[model samples]
Target: MIYLDYVSTTPLNQEVNHMYQSLLNDYFANADSLYSLGLKTSALMEKSRELTAQLLHVLPEEIIFTSGASESNSAAIKGCAFQYQNRGKHIITTAVEHSSVYQSCIQLRDVFGFEVDFISVDASGNLDLKQLEEAIRPDTILITMMYVNNEVGMVFPIEKVYQMIQKINPKIKLHVDMVQALGKMPIDLTHVDLASFSAHKIYGLKGSGVLYKKTSTSLVPLINGGQQEHQLRGGTSNTATHTMFAKTLRLALENLEQKYQYVTSLNHYIREQLTQIPDIVINTPSEHVSPYILNFSCVGYKPEVILHALEMYECYVSTKSTCSSHKSDISRTLQAMGIREDIAKSAIRISFSHHTTQDELDEFLFYLKKTLKTIKKQR
Candidate 1:
């Protein structure tokens, strides 16, 4: 199958997989144990933490490994809310965040009595900075925004947002959900207080993720048990997953520039080819978007119908965030951008990886065009 859903999850790298198997078999000891085997396992885990910190240009103590982006986002958002609720009860975020971030904010509002302000996005999924500035109040203790939109690939101006927040209220914490942006772009954690990352999104295993919390940032423990992950997270650490995540991240960053150039070219090719098809409307903005994802609407077709048609031809794509796929409702991200309900319901996301080949893309496009023609005839 020609897989076009890298944003959902990437195939694990062969090398990382091999390393994972080896580590899982050999270092099976509990990392928190006081025994010799446990010390060695714990050492390896710390090394992974250091490597992850080096990649993000942060201290090793700042990296807290979790199950995946969902958990990391929850830990960052909810943990921050509970830890700092005494100081302030107001939080700010964008409307186009991943379900994890959006739902976490909702929980805070519903259960914890925190006031949440969801800043609006433009038609292209870009956040309104002025509106964001206006949303920030003295009680705004935290601001959570995704660095890159998962479905539409719109790249938020994170650096600019950081600067704006610092100027307005240095006390307010900024948390970024960087799962889609981690391997696809250069990430500088200089001013970012906390950011979430997933290993599976960068060709690592599915069970590993990271939450980079600056040294000064305090968070209440999401899973309280033992002293693990610097008291930010608790449980027996998965040495295999953490080590493999570091290895995969290093490999991804090593060829970052080359991959960027290659994927951007492929993205352009896909967009150009897509425009030639009648009734196709590209939703992802031409500018200020990541090259790894392309979202579009087939004017009169349901996304599920098109997806199934393409699947028969061995061409795979996605409709919305995999986390929200069980729900048949219209795309929240698209709706937040003020897109028409029909167009939003018809949107499909095609995500690319560095390993996606030109020949594969060409074949997928051929099948996609044919599938669209078939669907149109039925209509």
Candidate 2:
């Protein structure tokens, strides 16, 4: 299939797959065992952690391996809320966050009795920093938002937000969900207290991801088991997959500028063609959006109709964040941006990768046009 859903997840990198197989075979011993083989395996995992930290410009001790961003987001939000509730029971987040961050914030407010402020975004999918600043109060303990929005690809002004929050309440922890921004955008977690990422989003195997927690930040454990993940998260990890993730992250960051430029050309091509279509309404902002992801509405047409139509031609795409796409038909992100309900209901996302070829995109556009025309005829 001609896949266009890189933001949801990517096929494993062939090189990373090879590394995983090699590590799996060589490091079969339990990392916690006292035996020599176990010690060797544990040491290798530590090296993997160091390499991953070095690539991300953070300390190895700050990185905690998790199942994926979902777990990381939940752990970061709930842990911070639980740890600092005595100091304050208030938190801040945006309306356009990924499901993991959004739901985690909701759970904090509903079940944990912590007050939450859902910061609003403009019609262009940009957050109002001034409003966000006003929402911060003495009781606010954390501010969690996405580095890049998953559905519309709107990049948040994270550094500015962090600086603002620091000035207001230096103790307020800043947690950023960086899942979609991993390989698609520049990253600097120097001032961020916590950040979350998923391996599957970056051509790495699933069931492995990273949660960077600053050394100074205090967070309660989300799980209690074999004392893994620095006691933040417990249970045995997929040591083989986690160990090979360093190489996977390295490969994703390599030649990022070249990859970005190439993908920008693809996005430009798709955007140009998509705008020419009669009933299309681009939901992704024209400016300040990542080229790796694009969003729009197939006006008056159910997104699934067009999606299935393209699928018949062996083209794959997504209607929204795959994790919660089945949970809701309408795009909550679009609606939060002030889009009309009908338009929001018909919204779909087309995500790209550096490996997506111009020829492949041309074929994709052909199939899209054909699908649209066929639907028009049926109507």
Best by lDDT: 1
**Candidate 1 per-residue C-alpha lDDT over 139-191 given as tens digits, one digit per residue, 9 for 90 to 100:** 89999999899989889998888888888998999999999888888998888
Candidate 2 Cα lDDT to native: 0.89
TM-score computed on alpha carbons, candidate 1 = 0.98
* Residue-pair clashes per candidate: 0, 0
Worst 10 residues of 1 by lDDT: 370-379
C-alpha root-mean-square deviation, each candidate: 1.2, 1.3
- Candidate 2, pairs of clashing residues: none
How high is the lDDT of residue 351 in model 1? Answer: 96
The residue-by-residue lDDT of candidate 2 on 222-310, one tens digit each, is 89887787888777767897797788899999998899999999999999888998888889998888999999888888888899999
After superposition of all CA atoms, the RMSD between model 2 and the true structure is 1.3
